[model samples]
Target: MTRRHRAGALVLSGMALVLTACGSPAATDTTDAVKAAARQSGDTVYPAQVANCGRTVRVDKAPERIVSFFPSNTELLLRLGLKNRIAGQTWTDQSPPKPAYATDYRKVKVLAPGEIGREALLAARPDFILADGEYQFDGKKLPTIAELAKLGVPVYIDSAFCPKTTGTATLTATTTDLTALGTLLDVQPAARQATAETRERLSAVDKALTGRPATRAAMVQIVDKQLYALAGGLYSDVVRRAGGRNVLDDTVPKGSNFAPLSAEALATKNPDVLIYHYTGAADRAASEKWLRTHLAATAAVRGNRLIAVPAADFSELRAVDGTVTLAKSLHPDAF
Candidate 1:
């Protein structure tokens, strides 16, 4: 299961130091002038407020000490050039910062390898927290947003993971979060540039696939020996944008993105392309072997259309990258 889904089930249980030194009067005056100019230019204003996951979060200034609860959220901050501000981060054994972020990722401290408890989080002394979803603040093993507010810490949950969000809005949700983070972090310019680039790449894929028939695809993963197909959320969105139709999209129930799949159902659906995601090469090989052995009769296996995608791509800022990668695989001539 995806981290989001896992965390949802566990709901019952769960910056850079800006160095400031006393400076000369002239230096202080210059700093004040710069602040005033920034305000006049409509840059990020202090005490910026936004409603996040039903909580009114207010940031008095760009966060200096940040605790990111998930690798995906950490990657978003890295993209925004806020790496130095990240004081700590947490990730599961299966999830790590993407290779592109390896160098910078090593600079930040890991608060824990897996789920962090309330005490560890408090020890980080974070002024702000970037969480994957509201599920992280379950008020059981983790601190609730209300509790954090009393301590002057504002929490920002990725809008894509907000409750009642639909798979169709995945692209919009990510771009929206990017814009909002840019505003809150005083990185509007960088955010705008990133957002534009993301849209441009997606647009290119759409243009290339225009008037073409979508390939029948299914994203499947083995969890505890059970086959689960992606029914909605970012994975489905990636398939849709890549000129492929998710055969299991309609099978997912409301508020969920995955559904159990049986061998009979797999053969019945008979997706033209079978997509599986993994974190490592070994895992990829294992999944591919499993598909070949168990579902050999399916058209996808017979045609050798099994594609392995990095699991991180489906959950992080790399969703666009996933879309492009899948597009190339599904419609090679178009790409």
Candidate 2:
């Protein structure tokens, strides 16, 4: 769901991309790092090794101070009952993942919508950091997870945004992330509960869609004046699960996730539904107006089948809720 990619396994020795993802299981240094990080974050300490997002990261114990570098990461942390452990958060553009407790976490540090220097992050001394990737991170300074690891800080990235990932994004991948994070944080129960609940929600949606026909659709994300067609990555998974078939699935190689959408081609192959991703209410209105005025003759527009999704929704842990919303909207008669 994040366009920016964080550094991946290629750079890490013995990552899933290399050496059978093997490394020293856990050394004294690992234990020491975990203890120290725990003290800073005020969480319990334990040791764990993870092959995450194609890379290996060792966590000695539960972190007390966890920095969430993306909205989705923040949502995951909160949903997993680690809100108090949040040392810092980025991407504070919309309603926070925990609106009811926004006032409670108001003192948490913010580090985004602009450049975040390595020094600033180090000063926060977070034990762990969760990020979507570097795709959206740009400003006066850029920092890599590799750099943080060197300083004894561990970073976990959502594999959905990994550039090296092959094929479509799967619900399995999201569960894997949750399981791995929970294991590392000593909160496996919470992770399992969250994943199970998400599955149950999706199952309910599936039941509602049992007799429904899927709509022909296209999911598009427009950024920097460029259109990115949703082929078979995270967004497509949502579309498919919601009873829609992406029209752009065959536009590219089978394993490729997304590519620049061709406007002319879209004009000719206009779909039954066009779901546009936009950030902020203003952007949503503008994007819908532009799509309607520019392609009013298309069946999707003429029939008012344009679905405007908040761009930020897909990044959060509750993203599946958005899928259910889409399915219900597309098949209002079913419910």
Q: Which digits, one per residue and each the tens of the lDDT, describe model 2 over residues 1-335?
A: 11111121212322333345455343334345445554344333456778866778788767888987766677778778887888888766643444644554566678664346766766777888887764533433645667667767788878676666635666556787887887777677788898898888889988988977889998886666667776777777888888998888877566677688767777677889989987667777777877777677777998889998766566446467678888887888777
- The C-alpha stretches of model 1 lying farther than 4 A from their native spots are 1-42, 166-168
TM-score of 2: 0.79
lDDT of 1 by residue, 118-184 (tens): 9999999999998877777889998788899889888888776777674444767778878788878
Candidate achieving the largest TM-score: 1
lDDT score for candidate 1 against the true structure: 0.79
lDDT of each: 0.79, 0.71
Question: In terms of lDDT, which candidate is strongest?
Answer: 1
Candidate 2: pairs in clash = 4-135, 5-134, 5-135, 6-133, 6-134, 41-64, 41-65, 46-60, 46-61, 47-60
Misplaced by over 4 Å in model 2 are: 1-45, 94-107, 134-140, 252-254
